[model samples]
Each structure stands twice: as C-alpha cells, then as structure tokens.
Target: MSTTPRIEVAAVADALYGKWKEERLAGRALASDPRLQTIPGQSMDEHRERVLEQLGLLVEAGAIQRAFPKHLGGSDNHGGNIAGFQELVFADPSMQIKSGVQWGLFGAAILHLGTEHHHNTWLPDVMSLKLPGAFAMTEIGHGSDVASVGTTATYDPETEEFVIHTPFKGAWKEFLGNAALHGQAAVVFAQLITNGVNHGVHAFMVPIRTPDGQMMPGIGSEDDGVKGGLNGIDNGRLHFTNVRIPRTNLLNRYGDVAADGTYSSHIESPGRRFFTMIGTLVQGRVSLDGAAVNAMKGALAIALRYGSERRQFSGADGKEVVLLDYGHYQRRLLPRLAETYAMQFADHKLLETFDEVFSGANDTDENREDLETLAAALKPLSTWAALDTLQEAREATGGAGFIAKNRLTGWRADLDIYVTFEGDNNVLLQLVGKRLLTEYAEQFKDGDVAAIAKVVAGQIGEGAARFGLRQMGQSIADLGKVARSVEGVRDPETQQALLADRVQTMVAQIAM
Candidate 1:
C-alpha cells in the first residue's frame, strides 16, 4: 500500500486563495460570464467596442468601486479591491487593462493626488463610466524619465489659469488608453512653471473631448491603429497647444500654487515632493504583480490539464504512456509549477503590505518607502516569469496550444506589454539596486570609526576565503571527495548560508 496521504482539495484551495477569498471568487464568477469574455477572432474595431461595453457591465456589477472612499459609495477596501481586480485576467487581459486605465490610473490620480473638492467634482462620473479618461504621463520624448517631461503648465497670475502646452512634437503624450475615441478628460502631467521658476512635475485635470466625442480646441489626437495585441484599448497620441484650465484644477495634495503665482508645498525639497507624489500611485505596480501571477496560474492550469490526458508512444507492456509520466516532461513543467506558487505567495505578501500603507493602519514614511521598493523589485520578476511560463506552457501543449481558441497565444501577446508599461523591467530593477546600495551606505553615514573598521576587516576576511588563503585547510581535507563537497550543500542551512554570503560580498564590493 502507498504511504502518502490523500490531498485535501478544499482546504488547499482556501489557503491558496489568501485573506480575500470572497472577493477573488466574486471576480472569477464575473469573468466566467460569456458576455465579458474575449471573442478570439473579432476585428480590432469590434474588440475595442466590445471592451467598452464590458466596462459598463463592470460598473453595473459594482466591480470597480471597492477602492474609493466610503462616502463615495465605495467599500474603502484596498487589498480586496486588488484581489478582485486580478481575476479579470481570466475574462480578457485587454479588458483587465482597459478597466485598470480607468479606475486604477485615471480615477486613482484624482483620489490620491487631488483634494476632496476635485474628487467630488470628477470621481462619481468616473465610477459610473459617464466620464472616461486617460492618464497622460508618458510623452514621446520621456517614458521612464517622468521628471523631465517636455510638456509645460505655465501659471498665469493675470487670468488665474495655467496654460498647458506641448512646445515640440516630442512633448506629445503617447500610448494613452482611451485617447483615440472615448476619453473626455485626462489627468495631464507637466512641469509646473510659475513666476519664471520651474517647480517640477505636477498633475492637472484637462478636458480632452466633449461629452458627444468631439475633440476640444487646442487638443489634437491620433489613433495608434492595430497593435501587436490588446487592440481593445484605443491607444493614441495627444498634443496640446495653449490649452488653458483654472488654477484650482491642479491636483495639489503634494504641492500647490496661490492665485498670485506663488508656489508652496508642505514638502520643502523638490526631489522629495516629486517622489512622494509618484509613490502614491505605486498601486499600479502592485496590481500588475498580482495580475501577472494570476496569468501564470492560468497558463499552468491549462497546460498541466492537457498534459495529463494526452498520450504518446507505447510502454513495454504495450499501453500508451501519458505525457506527464515521462521524466523529461516533468522536468520541463514541474519547476515552473513550483515557481508559480512562490510568485503567488510573494504577491499576497505584497498586497498585504499595500493594504497596510494605503489603509492608514501603518502609514509611516518608512513603511511607504518599503512598499515602493518591494513593488519595484517584485513586479519585474513576476511579469518576466509570467511571460517565460506562458511560453513554456504553450510549447508543452504542442499543436493545440497554437490554436486561437486555446487562449495561450492571445494571452502571450497581451501580456507582452506588461513588462514595459507600469515601469520597464530593467529600469525597475535599477531602482531596487539603488535602494540596496542606499541601505548599505546608511550604516556608515554616522561615521562610526569602529564599525567601519570592523566592516573593512570582515571584507578582507571574505576576500581571503574567496582566494583560498583561508579555506586551504578545508580544501586539502576534502580533496578527491566530490560527494563530500556536494553533501555539504545538500543541507538547507548550508545552502542558505552560501547564498547569503554571496549576496553580502557582492553588495559590499559595490558599496566600496
């Protein structure tokens, strides 16, 4: 008889579902509805229209309001909102992204960056789909360098308005969702200049189109046409020419301007103020991390289910061998399965930290900084892993995976942009590396001479160990005993110590 215990499916599922089980189940139920699911072979224009209609359905279902304030008909449930939102990947990645553009980006800017007056003026319409909008932060000339964007919002004290202008073609906002057709307004990011002094990047509410879909004066838009994927989004470019809005239109939670063109902010350092404003929008990365993990789960489930049933060749007993029974197949898929589980757990932890900061339960500056760094580090890894897993799953399923109806190819195309959008993977990893160096340097900031000497001595010891000067005795004892060397690393604690030592050595070298 086999000694292994039977698996408890229900208990395992409950644990895997994390703290927000009900919200995730609700989202999954909605995603299973045919009306909201993707139609594989639809035309680009048809897909775009279908997604727009689906956004309305989401509003009717009350699926997009959980993150807003309770006074505005929302639950103020930050973590649960993301838990639910991530499940939309099952319906369609395009739909998930389009909905994110509206509620997660555009509406969130108003909620986090703007004051109560601005929220009351715009958020209700935004929640109801009465006012579709765009988040215009990336320009043709500036994608990751948001601090140096070319668009300018020059304040005019005489008329008490800000003149928003795109001085050159490079200043035009590019790749904005909803800008081509449906957007009626946009939260535009530009350098704020008042009294001939540039006060760095700030956001403002600017009308881009009329209610009936006419482009507003001084605002020009151009369609991006068919893309490699996610055609359901009406991505486009927008340019401004002397477009003017009221001074009060500035989202002034971080920084503000007076009627006489004087700039003031509670945060004195311009650099600190800019980072604080941008950090509030870190939920974009947090949500993307979860969505990518969900996508990895979907891909693995499809591939593993197919692999278990499909058979090939014959065994010695003359029965066909199931694909998954082969060691080679197991090698290919099982490690990815393990990685997907790890990513999901990491995402859950990230979501918990996010809830802590945003819910004001532990909203200290240090906690916020930790949240930002965590998101920056994890988003890149999960998204890249999702792409790798999806491709492997597709290849594992053979001819069936290539078929449109199987959803692998379409999903791969849709998720290709996730690595670059919220923040480029390379750029985000650089941020994490910088944060690591900063943390390392902080220990030496107090000029503790004794502590510095100790660290220097430790580095010298590590160098000696690396060069075999200190490990010579152990090497001589272990010579000609490869199994003994391998046995040492077989212990988990030894493996962890080696890895931790490697990281500390590399970081110390970089810091010096």
Candidate 2:
C-alpha cells in the first residue's frame, strides 16, 4: 500500500473549517455554560424549560445579538453570527433549534424585512430575550408555500389598524416554537388587504401574549404535546380572530400602506416583491445547513472514538482487532467523513455569500437571488446527509451507540425534522431546480438565431453522448464484459459529464 498520499491533517482541517469559524468554535460560551448542560433522565417539560432558560443565558452572553446593526448594540458580523450559531449543536439539538427559532427565524424576520421603526421599537427587547417571539409563517394548510397562507391582515383606515384573522382551522399557524408558552409577540405572516386590493403575504408585529403570560384578545393557541423528538421545543399552533394591531405594525420594508389605506411598493411586480421579501431571510436556511453539518460531524466523532477503543474479532497474532482498523468499518465511515468535509466547505462559502448580500457589501437583485438559490441547494443536502450519517454512525457503534447517554439516537431523532424545518427538502430542491432552469433559459433568451442554434445543438450532443454511454455500459454488462465496462466509464471527467448531461436533460424536459 502506498503511504505517500496524505497532507497535514491539522492544517487541512483548519483550512476546511475556515479561520473565523475556528475562532467561534474555540470561543463557544456553551462549552462552559453550566446551565446549558444536558441532564440525565430529565423530563420533556423540564428539558423544555431548561432550553428556554438557556436562551436567556445566550442573550446574557450576547451570543444572539451579533447580526444586528452595530449602531444598535451589535457587532454587525453576519457571517460570524451564523458561524457561531451553527456550533450550538455541540450543546444540544433542542437548545440549538429553539434558540434558532427565536433568533434566526423570528428576530431575523423583523430585522431584515421590517423598517427602522420596527427595529428600534422591538429588536432591543428581542435581543435581550425580554420579549420572546414566534415566527408565525407556517400554517397547517401552507407550510412550504408561503404566498397561499389563508391568514388575512385587512387594513382598516377607520382606526388605522390592521385586522388579522385566520379564516379556518387549517389556517392556524402550526408547529411554531415559543407559541405554546414563552412568546409574547410574533412576526405574523398574513396576506395584506387594503381598499379591496389583496396584496401578497407580509409580516406584522402582532402581540400574542400579555405581560403576565396570558393570551391576548382574539388569540387562541394549543400546545403540541410529546412530539417524537425535539420536545425541548414548546411547539404549538396559534389562531387569530379579528385581531387588530396598529397599522404601523406591518413590517413594511418591501411594501407599505398609506393613511388612506392605499397599497404601494417600489417593486411593481407582485411576484418579484413577494420573492424579494422572502429572500431577505434566507439566512435561516443557511444556518440550518451548517448546523446539520455540525450534527453529522458530532455523531461521526462519537462513533469514531468508540470504534477506535472497542476491539472486535481476533487478529492474526491472536490479539483482538480494533473496529476502526477493519476495512469494512473504514469503508462505512470514511466516505461519509469525506462528504461532511465537502459540505462544510460548501457551507462556509454559502455563509460568506449570505453575509455579502445581507451586509450591503454586494446587495443586488442578482446577488440576493444567488444567495437564496445557494441556500436552497445546500440546505437539503446537508440536512439529509446529517440524518443518514447519524444512522450509519449509530449502526457502526453497535449497542453502545443506542444508549441514551451516548447522545447519538437523541441527536438523530431531533435532527429528523430538520429536513422539513426552515423549508422541506423536496420543495427546496424543486426551488433549486426551478432556478437552474430559469438561469438556463436566460442564457438562450438574448441569443440570436446562430447562438440559439449553437446552444441547442450543444445540449443535444451532450445528452446524446450520455445516452450512448449508458447504452454501451448496458451492452458490456449484458455480455459480461467487465473490463470494457470499467474502461468505458473509468475516467472521472466522463462520469461527471454524464451526470451533468443527465441532470440538464431532465431539467430541459421539465421546462418543456
């Protein structure tokens, strides 16, 4: 065996993880926070309370305030904020997720989509955990599709307030963290109607609870009890019935209403305006992508450590072989390890791109679109990989991995819903596929006859080559020609080209 194919492990790990990310990892407050430590045999209710307390601890340590404007008591470090946020999985998935719901989804919605008035009025309390809030976007009828939510916020010029209402049971905001217990307010998403003209979905600062933790007028909620996992999050559903809030409660960054109840927006196209509003909060997906990658790495670390210590069958010299030294064990873990590294690298790039857009350094329509597409693409891959890697790690560790003390199964179960959180995996990938097709079409739209012909011919040739290779592979396999089959597809370039061609062909067919 060749022993000359390795690089410096420490240096490689540092580079792959990114320097800022390494700093955040080294400086994690959760590492020393006694309150955030997991307790053995803790009840779900106890764990939920503990995790909520951990949010206050995080706020006290200023962990959740980094992404806010520097002028308003924050470091204004967007990328660093996400870098630190992702590392919380090392503490507990429930704590990480609940904190994410409070800060990333709820607080971030107001910060990004709301104007300065919303920020100055609400964000200080939000940052301090003095005002817990829910991101009321997902409804029973519309989790993946935000624009079709049945909740309505009708602007009333009579009182200069918006009347928010959930028309039916299915329109209730479902699976919302903080809505069950701690939330006093919510960045509620609803269709904005003014003067009989219904605008698309918009976020409003709606009060759900009073100072003494009682539900406000026209607000109803139910606790989602004893979920399969992530019970440390007090998930719940909320319904509104003719709830009226000040007209200024509307987070009007993208659109606004006049005192006369006239709706207006700088973005003329309703579709573009809606997308732009939604795109501003893509950091939730970006953070989830990195957090899922962190969970995968955590599981792999536990399994690898256990495997390196636990001896399996006897070796040639009558000494037992360590599980990690076996070829089968290596095969199972190494490929996934390599994949986690790849995802980490891609996630780092995604975080950087998100910061660039959000920091106003490269804020543009195209840049925002690119950031959103990158988030949609990478989130699905990392979350699905996390679940798969955790399962494999659990299996690799045998009985030890299944033990609750080891944390693998618990982490796996908690992460299971990540594939659906922020955005569902399949729906996100469909979004990515649509973006790909749209970009592909854009390339052909401005082309003259000659250029259009050239592109179409090229795509067809690529598809044909892919089809021919598959046919050749089939024929070789049918004749038992193993060597010829290997030769035909052995080149990495050939394999990649074939895969790309297949995907392109599929997208084209779907476009047609």
Candidate 3:
C-alpha cells in the first residue's frame, strides 16, 4: 500500500462496482430478449445464426464497445469497460466469448499492442463489428505452447511483406471462437523471422473472410461444428497457404521488422520480449477472471434463492421442507458461497491492480509482473469455482435445475467451456506455480543463502505454531482457538503469501 487516500480507492471502487450492477442488468435484458438465449440441441447452423444475431444485438446495444479509445468515441476508462463487459456471461458464454474473440482478443490486440498507424488502419472497422475478427493464437498442436507454433511469418524483402504460412497440419490454428462463420479478419500470431533471426511470436492482422462471406484466397477454414458445450460459438480451424500481408501488418508495439527485414524491439531479452507481447493480450485472462466470478454469483443467487423457496420431503407439519434447511444442502452450498464472496473481493483487487498498471499509474515492470501473477492466480481459482458452483447449483435444483426453463442447466452447460478457455485452469495454475518458484529463487540470487534459509525456516516455524500450538493436534478445535494474528492469515494478502509460500515450500521440499 502506498499512502494513497482511502477515499480515492473507495470512490473508484463504488463507481466500478456499480458498473457490475449495470452489467447484471444487461444480462437481464439479454435473458428476457429471447434473441440471445441458447436453445438445447440446436444444430450448428442454428447455433451460428443465433450467435451472429446476438453479437449484432450486443454491438447495437453498445455493450461490446466499452474498451475502445475515447478519441474513437469509446469511454476509454479501462476498469469501467471490463466491469460492464463481464456481465455478458449471463446471457450466453458463447456470445460472451465470441464477442471477446472480436473485441477483447482481436480489438485489444490492435488497441494495446498495435501502433497508432496500425490502429488508424484497421481499428475503425474492427470496433464497428464490420470487421468481426478471430484471435488465431491457439494452434492445433500448440494450444499453450505458443513459442513452439510452427506457423511462420518470414520476411520477404522483395515484396516488403511478411509471408505467413502453415506448412504443416500441426501449425493450423484451431478452436478459434469465430473462425468458422462470422469473422471477417483475424489477429494472427506466427513465429516472426526477419533477416534469418527468429524474433519469437508476434501478431499480424490478416483478412480471412471476405465482406461477402467467402474465405480469402490464401486462407482455408473448417467449422468445429458441435462442442461439448458453448455450441453457440462457431469454433473452427484455420490454415494459411502462404498468406502474404504488408510488413506493416505486424502489430509491432513490442517488436518490429523494419523495411530492411531486420528485427528490432524495445525489450532486449527474448524471454522478456515474449512475455511482454503476451502480457499485452492478458486482458483475455483478466476478463475471464471477472466473468468467472460474476458467473458464480449468478449461479449462487439463482440456486440460493431457489433453494430457499424450493420445498423438499414432507415434515411433521405435513408441509414440505425448504431445501436450504437441510444440513447437507448447506454443506454443499455454503463453502462455495464463501468462495464466491472471497473471490469477489479478490476480483476487485485484481481489477484495481490491472487499472493501475494499464493506466500508467503504476506501469513499472514489477507492477506488470504483479498484475500478471494476480491474474494467473485468480483466474484459475474463479474459473474452477464457476464450474464447481454451477454443477452444485444444477444438482441442488434437482430436475427443475436440469430443465432449460429455470436456466440452471443451461448456465451449467455453458460455463463448462470457461474452465478451458482464456487458458486451461490446470495450465494457468502451473504458470502461477512457476512464477512463485521464481519469486522464491530471487531471494537467494544475491549470494545470501543464509537469508533465504532463515526466511524459509521462519515460515515453517510459523506454520508449525499455527498447526501445533493453535490446534493441539485435536480432531476438532474452535474457530476462535487460534491467535488473532494466526487467524489474520485468512486475510487475502496473507492468503496470497501462503499460497506463494506453499509453492515455494513444495519446490524446496522436492529439492531436499
């Protein structure tokens, strides 16, 4: 904490929090609108039709344009934009994700990672949905391993263009949210090679579908017709057969290929340069973090309210019992309720840090790293929680929940895909785990092994104090039995430290 005024934070939080309420209202508008709701067992064409229609509704409502530049007539307030954008999950996750494919991934790739020249060249159409786009990063064989993607963007000095090609099937981009149908363009990522030097992965704007809905000459696509869920999205695959675009097509805020085809960049180290490029696109994870939390709240509000009203087996009064009155019911729901409350606070903190870094209030490299770690941490937790909460809510409502009429079953089915998008939950958590190890390893990088050992030993002693002195090894202990300091460990900051510490602890224990 800097010595910033408490009132400043609260005032900002109040305004942003109200945006979430407005987002909820947006959800209600869509849910009642019928045009946006998902129909069960809908065919691929029907799904595509509904998805395109809903995306148009979202654009017409101005719900999908919140994150653009004010010079371009957007609000340009980063925090408020995300707050409102996240509520789209309630109507349909497919709509939310396909909208994200167009705006958050594609438009943001231009807004954040592109130069003003690139923005002026392409963003007007992209922002207006006239150039609806795909984020073509996840390839068929390289889902999480972006660096290993075989799609190549080789510079051609003769044409002053970058020749991008998918020479192998494994290099073809897959599972793209809008590739099959509506996308007119894509923010394509390929390994950038210029002057015989590999410059790591970078983004390029590629026109895929023509304005008349035909695939472009060098681009080929196949629809991933039906999915386990999120069937409303036209998930598809893309292959480029020597697609050529102007060298200026590279979204080169982080790295550039000059007219001479020599690679140059602001960040020196390839590792740092790669992370910087990817970090620019991290609003994907950031939005997912907030959306997952909102989804959980939706699940809980519906289930808890319904659970309270829903009557179960008969009681002595010859009336059915409220489902929530059962201990088993509370046992199933309360822990998730606790998780949702805690995660809402965590989401706010993540949003504050995101605004701080992106708004340049705290744009230090350290702050950016912190923001990424916070996103990686909270995103995994919230997505997994959303899936778990939705499942529990579905079961809690019994067959009524299973029906589409009540919305629980549909919400459950839709949210199933969230755990896999933005990044898989397991993969995101593993990234967090790696970051934690690096943080701990830094403690000893200054030739101060004793200090690192002492720090680790000190933490172990504290853990022992809480477990041994506080609990006395008993099967049960009162919640108040521990010292206030020990219990303060439950605070979010303390929880963050322990989670990091546990990662370090596991690494250390493994090494020993």
Q: Give the lDDT of residue 260 in candidate 2.
A: 93
Q: What is the C-alpha lDDT profile of model 1 across 1-512, one tens digit per residue? A: 99999989998888778989999999999999999999998999999999999999999998999999999999999999999999999899989999999999999999999999999999999999999999999999999999999999999999999999999999999999999989999999999999999999999999999999899999999999999889899999999999999999999999999999999999999999999999999998999998999999999999999889999999989999999999999998999999988888888988999999999998998899899999999999999999999999999999999998898898899999999999999999999899989988987888999988877776775644643333433544666575656565565665565666677788888887
RMSD for all candidates, in order, please.
Answer: 3.5, 4.5, 5.8
lDDT of predicted model 2: 0.87
TM-score of each: 0.93, 0.90, 0.88
- Candidate 2 per-residue lDDT, tens place, 1-512, comes to 99788899989877766846554664355644657766646898999899998888888777878899887898888998888888887777788888888888889999989999998998888888889999999999999988999999999999999999999998999999999999999999999999999989999999999977899999999999888788888999999999999999999999999989999899999999988888888888998998899888888998899889999889999999999999999999999999999899899889889888988899898888889988999999999999999999999999988988788888888889989988899999999998998877876787688888876776565444455466656758786888767776766666776777777778877776
lDDT for 180 (candidate 2):
96
Report the number of clashing residue pairs per model.
Answer: 0, 0, 0
Candidate 2 regions off by >4 Å?
A: 1-6, 26-29, 460-512
- lDDT of each candidate versus the true structure: 0.92, 0.87, 0.80
lDDT by residue for model 3 over 219-240, one digit each (tens)?
9999887777788778899999
lDDT of 1: 0.92
True lDDT of residue 263, candidate 2 = 91
Model 3 residue 82 lDDT score: 75
